[model samples]
Target: MPEPANALQRLHVHLNETRLLGSISSALYYDQNTVMPAAGAEWRGEQLALLASQIHARQSSARYAELVGEAEAELEAETKAELGPSVPTERRRNLQLVRLELERQRCLDPALVASLARAQSKGNALWQTARRHNDFPTFAPALAELIALRREQAGQLAAAEAVPRSPWEVLAQPFEPDISKTRLEELFSPLKATLPGLLEQVAAAPAQQGGLNEAAAELPEAEQESLCSELLNSWGYDPARCQRSRSAHPFSCTLGPQDFRITTRVVPGQPFSSFLATAHEWGHSLYEQGLPRSTDHYFPWPLGEATSMGVHESQSLFWECRVARGRAFAARWQPRFVAGAGGDPWGGVDGFWRALNPMRPGPTRVEADELSYGLHIVLRFELELALLEGGLPVADLPGEWNRRMVELLGLRPASDSEGCLQDIHWAEGLFGYFPSYALGHLISAQLAAAMQRQIGPIETHVAAGQERVVQQWLAAHVWPLGRAVNGEELVEQVTGERLSAAPFLSYLEAKVQQLLASAHH
Candidate 1:
């Protein structure tokens, strides 16, 4: 804990302060989404724009660039003296990531950065209002403005990218580095071919197929909150390090190194939404909490960051889908739901498990079941490509969305709120982000196979209420790696197989057969 007296130390100090500024923005964002009133939207937009400009300036400044160069030179000298030449190190990787980001930041105009931030804030505010009113027209102009600003931003960053990338790909780099359109199509092709068939099979099954969706009694909101709290406490949610709140959409946010927050919304008729969302968001927080930040130097460096949104989503899905939605988990929690409702509303444990594993399609992506979730992502992915790359008009989004829904999930949304405005990603100008949700399913399934190979089945742990065992397995294998590898490499490293959709499709198929068999009993 000595004072900084070297180039590397100075770089750490600089980055630490920069992270402080960035965290301020995160805190404001959490407040805006959670508690900010409607009248505060414009001022919030201005505040966010000002911070965006400042953060952009700091990242792209010549002073910061010089410090990075000095740090690189210093690290090289230290490595050469302490070890042999040509040896790679995590510090080296950290510097490389920082340099890449610096170049991208330098390529952008500060004015554009401010404009994009303002537009994103405005777009989010407008989207909430429009969604509540089921009025797409009110939000269409904001969406158009976000798209234009983001396109311009991508155009500016394109020159700085080492390889040629499409506008959407350029925007996606921050979320999933080194991802390409060709690779996505390769990964998604199997899902596109297989999932619809699975959906059709479920549709043709006998009564009780894919669970009795309308049979469960709805738990009161207060009961849902209490149950959700119990679920988190059981899963190692420490009140000291984390907090939960209500929001328009469920999400996880990190404000400081130790300060974590998650939000969930209770759908009146959907009794398990809050409980499952809590589990999902807690998965995200656990990963963030477990990132390699044991020291002051690590938190500010790239090596301490989550590698990709896909991998992040994988962690959340591991808890939400693999564990929370698994039969063993349902058996353990069935009594709790029953007690909360003051009656056995789901008939029995098997019926409760069926409710948790509803294998049907839906209009909203967030509430879609595991069997049809990939289809939701596929729909959004295709639409994103069209909107960003194919010049799909904003006004036509609703019409095209309904068309794709019928083709993909065989259901059309009756309102814009459930259709195009269900997600908060595009409202904030987040293009090329939906694909990660599908990728998460694939990654989670593959990683679960690997976990089972090493320790035991995840279901076994859930049955004994030993989720900490599952958490430990991930902590040792996945969390520590951080940005040491991207999403695909992390999968291959852990699972000893190249990433594919076979594991996910296999899981879904087996799940379908099990649920169908349970109906007979």
Candidate 2:
């Protein structure tokens, strides 16, 4: 094509290139997790380190800053000339976002950038082995190195922040902008106070007889895969733009504007694991696919990206917890599951729903019920604060993790794999991301309420096998907002209320009563 005459056009070209590099990094990461061989990790780390350094250089370079400056000057002139608020609003916001990101990138040392990439790659490899062997010692050194590197990173980025922030807060800002520990405490305190009591209520209830066992719940991997495919197809998963694979940990990622990937692992006995995980990951993929990618201004721009990890998680949990685990969905799909397993293991539809909505507290966070999921996040959020700010030693993590698990959920992990090493976030030096998971539950609940208010009941649509209507609502309301707002702002804008633990807690209570009522029948 011809060379761009305008500064804005030139800046678009620059951002497009930057997005290309970032997507390449994502592709490499996806491969590493899904199919890359064990021995290739070292070379992959080196490759990623090189790419990280190059991308940092491009983002922080004087030339890119000059282009951004020129674009801002042109945008201001155009905005002043315009009669109304049509083009200038989103474009102006995009430029502002770009400027802030530029400042933060400029503050980081390139060596540190490269080092962090290598550390993250190495840390992920170490974590996989360590988790598999239940060996925390083998992974502790890498975790310490990552924490030290990230602390230094936070210290550097603090200078670029518009407001004063603590080290943990600084590290967290990239995930949830304008987030503070005080706000997290305010939001999570309700969960801390209430969830355990709810858990106790479930625990104190009499156990239902003839519940599912390992043998009863087991489905072969092939059957699980088939069921997952059916679920995705029923929910609008198009293979042309989206692909599914297996991974150690379930996740979804965008390799490019059109390339979406999700992965889930089938456990030996947990028949629901792969199916629910597929739903969860596809929810993430749907959000990614629905993001603004139509115009050039959207794809290579901040507005095209996800607003926050919390919102992203809300999408996943909406499918996993809200829809897949709901009574309507269980009633709908229980027949297929029984056919796949060659037996009616769950006894009946209500029994299948109970199996899906197992309300008991558990050692594993991924396998946790709605009542206990937020507590898992609370435990991680506090431990992160303790490790990053409260001077908790790395060697003491296992003990501390176990103590918190018992305190919060009344369960203790039997091994390091199930305890401190359960999540891959800390291993990769993600200090402030856990809170978003809890925040997601809250956001999902509140949004669901709003969605129900607008379109009657979600369960009604779900029971009617009209999930497309639900997807249409979210696509119109939620996905297009993108980075125009932060997580809480998005919640308030969509739901007309500030995010809180109330909706999620209320939903959990009602669901628990329903489950108990069914048990009595």
Off by over 4 Å in 2: 82-86, 208-210
| Total clashes in model 2, counting residue pairs 3 or more apart in sequence or in different chains | 0
- Candidate 1 structure lDDT: 0.90
TM-score of each: 0.98, 0.98
Write out the backbone clash pairs for model 2.
none
lDDT of each: 0.90, 0.91
lDDT by residue (312-332, candidate 2, tens digit) is 999999999999999899999
The candidate scoring highest on TM-score is: 2
Alpha-carbon RMSD of each model: 1.7, 1.2
Q: What is the C-alpha lDDT profile of model 1 across 219-338, one tens digit per residue?
A: 899999999999999999889989999999999999988899999999979998999999899999999998988673378899889979999999999999999999999999999988
Worst 10 residues of 1 by lDDT: 206-215
Clashing pairs for model 1 are none
